[model samples]
Target: SGMLITGVTTLLLSLLVLALAWWASIRGAQMRSSLPPGPTPLGLLGNLLQLEFGGLDRALMKVAQTLSRNWGPIFTVWLGPRPAVVLCGYAALRDALVLQADTFSGRGAMPVFQRFTRGNGIVFSNGPRWRTLRNFALGTLKEFGMGTRSIEEHIMEEAACLLGEFQATNGTPLDPQRLLDNAVSNVICSAVFGKRYGYEDPEFLRLLELFNDNFRIMSSRWGEVYNIFPSLLDWLPGPHHQIFQNFEELRTFISEQIQQHQETRKFGEPHDFIDCFLDQMDKVLAPQDPESHFQEETLVMTTHNLFFGGTETTSTTLLCLTDSCPAQVQAELDAVVGRARAPCLEDRVRLPYTNAVLHEIQRFISVLPLGLPRALTRDTHLRSHFLPKGTMVIPLLVSAHRDPTQFKDPDCFNPTNFLDERGEFQSNEAFMPFAPGKRMCLGAGLARSEIFLFLTAILQKFHLLPVESPSNIDLTPQCTGLGNVPPAFQLRLMAR
Candidate 1:
């Protein structure tokens, strides 16, 4: 009797397992039918197997480019079980993000950030919260002189300090990573915290390391896996947990700054971003309105977004300049602005070749290639496909940067890509390094100014002598996921 009961139980369990698998297949099929078509996904894994986990950003671009040939420009790919609509080539991206901006401006779930942020910050939050914080941030940043001549002065001051540091190296080959990080970070710090740290300050160095480590890990395969399976990865041991720990340390630092500001700040007088936010909070937070978004946590997260965004991307771009030293740009700099003064924003118009070189650097490296993921605000028709509200969208920014139709020989680092027949700097509609639409990077103006000022300032004073021959210097990124991390290289800065 016992033997017979065991057999019957085993048979029932098998039947139940098979039934569940069948149901999942049917459900997945229904979801796919509603979305645009791509390579058929396997059970549970979706299209994950098709991607190269180590360099997810490049792999996605390659896969999309190949699949688009058969699947059209607007097609779907399964990131785990979630379906994301990818906008390939310049036309597809422009049509969706520009022509129909509002409909495609919603923020999507990025499990890595979602876990820590919980939808509280400006970058990840959707709906009213995002709008309120974004508007407030824009106003506050402007007041701090983000896009004005005042901010340019701050950047120029920082650049002078940076040149001193490089000169201190005495033309020895050294990695400019940390020094560049410090210079770029100080610019944002002056606005956000109303102060700057010495380059060798231990505490400041520790904080920058946290930022660097988090960016690198988040741009590795470990980050890709965590985003795909956050719950499972939480139980497993890995380097990804370091990301949260770093976030906690960063949050603690920001909170401490907020506390100090609260103790020192006056009611009507504001000195920096933290002071402005505190002033706003005092006016807005009421007992009747318990769900106000201007709480302390929001302040920390928004400040974190500004600090991190302001520092990492710009610094990485500066570091990559080590690999590129076009003589024509230097010649333009020498002719237009002599060594008597430093390069300024006004110099960009006068030095067309130098301006073109900077544009080409951004276009060639294509940092943040995948960009922050976007979602649909409402049910909308894109091309021939009907995408319901809240559908995930992935804009392949690198695709547009490398779009052959928009740029000639897009793969190479040629300044002529941004120059016209008359050798004048000509702007292309597809030159969107910061992405596009309403949700585009708020710091775009500030970032562009920094890249132009810092690069020209450095080149004007020092000659970047790469350790290896220019032809042999590799421009391939160390990793490509959250951002394209330039490979590790050292260069000597000889005083010109």
Candidate 2:
């Protein structure tokens, strides 16, 4: 009788699994019917098995490129039961993100971050809340000297401090990750928190570690799985859980800073991002408008958005600068800027080779390769396919970077990709490291300035020497999901 009961139970479970898989397939088909054509999905797994999850970014580009050849540039891929339309190549991305900017402006639900963000912060939020926070943040950032001479001065000051730290290393082979993190983060810190932490500050180091830790976990396979199966992963044990814990700790730190700003800030004279936000809250928040978006929680999340976005990508890009200073770049820098004065933003045009090198680095690395997924604000048609409103769209950014039609050598690290015959820096429409259109990165301008200023400053003062031979240096990302994490490397800095 016990054996009979076990057999019956097993039969029922198998039947249940069959039913669920049938439902998932049928649902996926319906979703794909209205969307562009692509690979057929299997059960709840969708087209997941078809994708290489080990290195998601590269895997995505590979899979998308193949599928695009079959289904055209804009086609659907199933991420579990969820069907996402991928915008491959330069033309498709521009057609959607640039031509139909407002139509593709909605933020797609990234299950990993959506659980924590809950549609609140500037980056993750949509609709009125996003508009409100973004405008406010932009205004506040500008007021705090973003894109101004004042911000350039601030970056230069931080660069000088960075040089001092590098000098202290005394040509010893050292991984400059933390030092770079500190210097890059301090720029955002000055604007947001109104102060900068010392390189050895315990609290500051802990914060940086949390950011690093979360970024790594989020860029891992675990993060990819969590995005697809958040409900299941929530019950299971994994490193992805560390992401939420780190988020909580980061939120706690931000809350503490907000409290400090609240206590210290004087009315009508906003000092930093937090202060300006607090001032806005005072004007906007009232008893009648209880659902105002400018609340304390929003403040924490928006600040978190800026703090994390500002630090991680730029620092990772800096890490990718392991190659010895190119003779041409050094020569251009010497001829135009010279060693007496630091390279300024205006010198970007004067130092074409150096500028080309920076652009090539961003393009080759393609950090944030599969950029933040964009959602359709309304029903739209692209290239004979009709997509419904709220459809998730993955703008395969690396495809644009690697688009052969646009770049001379899409696969290799060649500064000539951005250089004209005259050796002058030329712009490519497909060169979008910050992503493009209405939903572009908030710190795009600041990031460009930081990259140029920081790199030029370092190369002007020191010759970067890799611990390993140039041919052996691995430029592949440590992880390639959320961001292209540069591999760990050490280099000696000999003062020029």
Clash totals for all candidate models: 0, 0
Q: Which ten residues in a row have the lowest lDDT in candidate 2?
A: 318-327
**Candidate 1's TM-score:** 0.95
Maximum-TM-score candidate: 2
- CA lDDT of every candidate: 0.87, 0.88
How much is 399 displaced in model 2, in angstroms? 0.2
Show the colliding residue pairs in model 2. Answer: none
* Model 1, C-alpha of 144: deviation from truth (Å): 1.9
Per-residue lDDT value at 415 in model 2? 86
Superposed model 2: Cα runs more than 4 Å off: 1-9, 146-149
Candidate 1 per-residue lDDT over residues 1-496, each given as its tens digit: 9999999999998998677657656777998888999878776577889878867667777877776778888888787767788888889999999999999889888998898789988899999999999999999899869522389999999999999999999999998888999999988888888888999999889889999998999999999889887887999999999999999999999999999999999987888888999999999988988889899999999998887788888877766576555466778888999999999999899988888888888888988888889999999998899999998998988889999999999988788988899999999888888988988998999999999999999999989888888778887888889888888888999998
Q: Pick the candidate with the highest lDDT.
A: 2
Native-to-model Cα distance after best TM-score fit, residue 175 in candidate 1, in Å? 0.5
lDDT, model 1:
0.87
Clash list (residue pairs), candidate 1: none
